[model samples]
Target chain A: MRGLFAARPLLLWPAGCALLVASVAVAITIGPAGISVGEVAAVTVSRLGGADSGLSAIREGIVWDLRLPRTLLAAVCGAGLALCGVVMQSLLRNPLADPFVLGVSSGASTGAVLVVVLGVGGGALSLSTGAFLGAACSFALVLGLGHLSGGTTDRVVLSGVATMQLFSALTSLVVMSSADPEQTRGVLFWLLGSLSGASWPDVWPCLLVLLLALPACLGRAPALDALVFGQDAAGSLGIHVARTRLALLGVTALMTAALVSVVGAIGFVGLVLPHAARAIVGPGHRRLLPVSALAGAIFLVWADTVARTVLDPQELPVGVVTSLIGVPAFVHILYRGRRTA
Target chain B: MSLRAEDVSWSVGGRMIVAGVSLEPAPGQTVGLLGPNGSGKSTLLRLLAGVRRTSSGVVRLDGAPLEEIGRKGAARRIAVVEQEATPQVDLTVGDVVRLGRIPHRRAWAPLSSADEAAVEAALGHTGLTDQAEQSWHTLSGGERQRAHIARALAQEPRELLLDEPTNHLDVRHQLELLDLITRLPVTTVIALHDLNLASMFCDHLVVLREGRVVAAGPPERVVTPRLVSEVYGVRAVVSPDGPGGRPYVRFLPPTGEAR
Candidate 1:
């Protein structure tokens, strides 16, 4: 776990960012019609200068319209999910607590689908707003269930799983009963997580959330360090246990709701990236949160690139690649926990 | 600064865990709280630390009510080490100790040189400097105890409260921990089960029985054979004193046959 530049963690922020930039530059070039990494970079730089890089307008359009926005969205989603993973793990004092695994995202999916199908607010509320409400509902349900069942880590996780199943069933019923074939297709694509139609419109809100949530999380890092020890220790250290828990819960839920609404229920980035970043930067959130965010951005940029390029003309859902990676990662964590215990 | 509890009480589920108990330790005194199992030692310590709100009565820090100062303000002056301080995370010894600086640091401010020096001094005081980078989960019970003390020490607090800190420690570590607490120029309130350790190190002793103060005074006077036998259900004779010049309790054979 201490292998990834744990000693010089300050170096990780800039290095990780540079790695993301390079990965984006390289990943944008890979697609059905072969374009080189160098050509991708040139086209991107030329567009920045407001000059057409002597390539065909079709290639330029592909670079600007299709690939760039999708890649950036992937980065944002990855960072947001991972950052929230750091928060949920610390807040719940359980590493197994991720939005997707705990079924918190299923709540958001239900909200978005409610809007997509039944039109819950009669055009007054957006899908994103509904999704946020659903996330909060799921969070409340999980906490209530956990309290009812003694609220151990195992119980909390089980409650999350239960909440997830219930919401998913309700979401499917809403979709199946109401949506037309075309809207159903889009909803299905969303459920599975496809970044097919990414644009600048999708970029700003995510950027705004990241800008707001990342610093907010950073401010709570020290309090989080005490929390992983236990509530008593945190309280002794002068943390108002109930208030701190409430604040962190609100922050993590908000960020996760926003990200899930934008990009369906993208799993694994939340679970995988935080652990990876912990190994690289050690367990303090001051370093871990930023490193996790960067690692997530780097991870998804490549995952999304692979999702698009793995099958030349046909595209795969980004969630498919992440799940393929996440299942093994989760098993490894359980194994590690057993060995340590 | 002094810590004074004025008729403090706490209850849970309508059961009185800590009944009316008032205690006042002098400035920079090492006061040991001794009690039998289920005698409210831990509860009293929590009340003193302001982590547990008292059902009735006030715990004052240097004359100001502890709760009135607020958690952040109280934490700035008081550091409490609970009995179970083992962390359930992949953290190093350094990471745990650094948390003591939380009440002191601004949320946005990074760890300063002063914070580093405090942590360094604490690790050294607890003889944990070499293990600062060691994984927390890998520590032995005694080492973990020391790490907890080191963490509390890192807070640079004026009032220190420890709940049964020596339970997991070996004899040497137990002595070392109490020795460090007595020598540190702070108002220390420690809850201990070992009467001998309490007698040898603490400036004063407060003994609790069923959530009430049964005895309170210097160790030599308060630690009587009758007191030990009555409070702990043990038949013991009070020897003259240990090498530390404090009364030692030597148990005689039980008056009743072993059932």
Candidate 2:
């Protein structure tokens, strides 16, 4: 890995691309029905204009309508969150910062919960819209607080923590006051996060947002790198530090809101995946962002698959599975960081 | 490149730190700012570097108002190495030096060949080539200071501003670092507390007392016994060094009346 990073990064790009393809194939194959590898490939090929096979319509529906969309959503959400985490960590100069650290996830959850429980504008809008709005509001609050407290790292973290707690309390209130038992279940499931409702329609928006934001994040990689040195030094380098940070936060928030609306609050993927990627590759964001994204996508897809298959006929929440895996890994990384420091 | 500050004054909280201070550093000349601790030497360096805006004066680079040039443009012209910079992450020596190229890079572009060459040159100039791959935390105090210098050097700047570059360096490394600064082909302004080192390397001297310039001239003209005694409140003997004509100051034990 060291030599791979030391040499031309163009080499690693191809390997990561190959891994992404393989991971997607594996994800599409491993599910509750236990389709054969050949059948999986045949079904996939047939769907993509290959010759017709013995696969039934049910298998086709599962592969095309359910598994494919869910896998794609996982990949896109994973990539987006990981990229968001990388940028946030660098911008804040704090290793612990993730998309949720700014209370974006809580904001998203509140929006989602309101829609699920209270109903929005007489069903005029869905939970996704509320999630976006909540995410935007929380992001704006964090930015405002950061400015108020001199835009320092401590200020950002404090604001994020405060906003997170406030929104979380509100979310809990909404969930607790629900009279219907099913409504509580819906809110609880959404909080735990899943791709169970993922469909083709949900895939396009996430794909679009991820595609647009990823390149922009990559373009600002040098500026992000400069930020690791500190704001004053970055300012001296003519980085327009505040403006760049605001723009990045806005874009990341938008991506997070979109993903959270789809999968609910999938934690740890954003917080831990970037560190894993950084440990493998160096802290250079240009390579770090994409690799982290790919790794994150691969991780979530497999985690989601395990959540589905862990107890057949009853799926666990994907967020629960990811947290179970991510927390230990995150702690291990922290331990290593402590040793190194 | 001449840096001129006119009637520059700065106050923090409610106390004035630098008041009505004016000075100039000519192109390709090395000027020393000397003062006791808390005499505003560091503040003066900060003002000259345009890191801080003065409350009531103008600082010009090459006769143009510093604000006229944008931050990045000013950065290209003036590079500052502060007294203490301890980054949290464990960046390699090469990584730290590459940061100096930030102002020159476009938003998306990778480090160009020219940029890489400049980094290499800086590392070579600072004699840190062997330590390029080493983590910054592993370096000695003097090595870390040199790494900071290499970072500033990679900017390829026109004027170098240093605030006590030798603060933590040993005597040998201090002399070596000052020697390297003196040999650079650029205007240099440094805030220093070591009178002998300043007198040895600086072409011009500006002595400060209580946020004001007490004396400004060549070392020979500025480092007199009475001048040192009066400004520093210490009895000192001053003598000509050699035919090379630099004044060398020898301190006498402070008498009770000296203060």
Candidate 3:
């Protein structure tokens, strides 16, 4: 998608859609199972009330129940994380800002640990609910601290860093003190992020959240453009600076919380994808947001495919896979930027 | 009158930055605000531009109170260029200029024909047609200021406010920028440091000292050596040999002490 039809911006969107579809289709075919694209399409059509797919129960279950949900979740999380990253980076005017930079992921981990190891929710609350609650609390804390520190962009980032450190420490202390070795391993696996537990229930809520958040962010693209100049300049340009900042920051936080609760904090997708997308589409938020979302979707689909299948019997963490690929790609982007500059 | 500030005062942390200042610039008049460092020139301009609310008194735009107008409505009428507003993102010159059309555009709509035409006219007016596709990071300081002015011009504003717009420019670029500003039909209120340049370009001059208007009139009457000594604590000679009989100020060295 980087060089293909890039000269003609009109064809970029259609090409992006096709690339994303192709990525999902191809990614679904890569697992331990020997399901082909036709079988996968037949199982999907059969689920949608088409004719029966000529496949046994085991193969159908693997396609319908297992691989489809995981792959779709990967795409959804990828798009959502990248969207949140674009919003955060633009709103805060900080290039280093990411979805989890504001401590949402750390808070989610703490919440999951509390529910899983300490049994704080008394068996009624699921892990995702606990994580969501924790993420919200962390975001609220960051906002409060930022407000106390004069509500400037740098102050917000400083507060986010402080909140992240606090929540991370709390999560570590709780897991270390109370959990057994088995519980510790389980918490660690979720902390490092994996898509192995992706189910249909986890997929839809995230997709719904992404669907709601994408349009909402798109509507504020012009406001984000105004914000590239400082707050006074934006105010002079008719942007309600405080209101636009709050709305965008809130959308990013909610989307980040939803995705983190579902996928256990997939790293690098939020931080790196926006830069890659910006390189493709330039800094205009209208093109940058959608391009980032698509690029992220394609990227994570492939990353998750490699994560689950690289070691064959043992699954490496998706976060590990992302960093392994993200670092070299990040270096390449920096090198190119240097040459261009 | 296009823009009027009557007894406007702004204070921060119990310190008055602009105290009881009144300014009224007629339509298409270029008013220069002259002051030493921290004499509230920037604050006065901000208040007049509706970028900051006055602590006391009123600012009226076209006989309507500025606070009554909505942000978008005010922005459509007034565009401000501050001293420091460099964007962090790597944007093209065209992208920076297109930001001026935000007020005229709706949230979900694409650029209208009017917006494009205005942008093109602004780029043409600033002589930046060839540099529109250039990266903003590669632009020189003067070109950056011209781009900023072009962005403001794209708003099609009736009133323009600038704070030390030529602070970082060379002499030729400074004259070119101020020349461009004075030729615009919009009523402009600019804060400037150079007395001779201010006198040469500004139709009227308002000198500020300690947040108060020390002198206000045509540049020839206001740019005297006595006013310079009183307001800026410096000795200067004002001669009427400048362009168009505007006063030219030449500073004289102190005879006794460095203080």
**Which CAPRI quality tier does the interface of model 2 achieve?**
medium
Model 1 misplaced stretches (Cα beyond 4 Å)? A1-4, A36-49, A52-57, A101-103, A113-130, A143-159, A172-189, A327-341, B252-259
Evaluate model 1 with DockQ and give the value.
0.64
Taken over the whole model, the C-alpha lDDT of each candidate is 0.84, 0.85, 0.91
Error of 1 at B203 (Å): 2.3
Listed in order, each prediction's TM-score against the native is 0.90, 0.89, 0.97
Worst 10 residues of 2 chain B by lDDT: B237-246
When summed lDDT is taken over every stretch of 10 residues in candidate 3 chain A, the lowest stretch is: A1-10
Report the C-alpha lDDT of model 2 over A253-337, residue by residue, as the tens digit. Answer: 8898888877888888988998888777777777788889988888888888888888888888899999999989888887876
Better of 2 and 3 by DockQ: 3
lDDT (Cα, tens digit) per residue for candidate 3, span B183-208: 99899999999999999999999999
Given the true complex, what DockQ would model 2 score?
0.50
Candidate 1 vs candidate 3: the DockQ winner is 3
- Chain B TM-score, all predictions listed: 0.95, 0.95, 0.98
Candidate 2 lDDT, tens digit per residue, B1-259? 4778998999988788998999888889999999889999988887887777788898998888878876778888788887777765567898889989988988677899999999999999999999998877788999988998899899998888998999978899999999999999989999999888889999999999888899999988898888887778888888888237788888999666727
Q: List clashing residue pairs in candidate 1.
A: A1-A279
Per-residue CA lDDT of model 3 for A1-341, tens digit only, reads 23444356789888899999888888889888877888999999999999999899999998889999999999999999999989989888998899997889999999999999999879999888999999999999999999998999999999999999999999999998999999998888888788997899999999998999999999999889998988889889988889888988888889999988888888988999999998888888888899999999999999999999999989988999999999999888888777345
- What DockQ values do the models have? 0.64, 0.50, 0.76
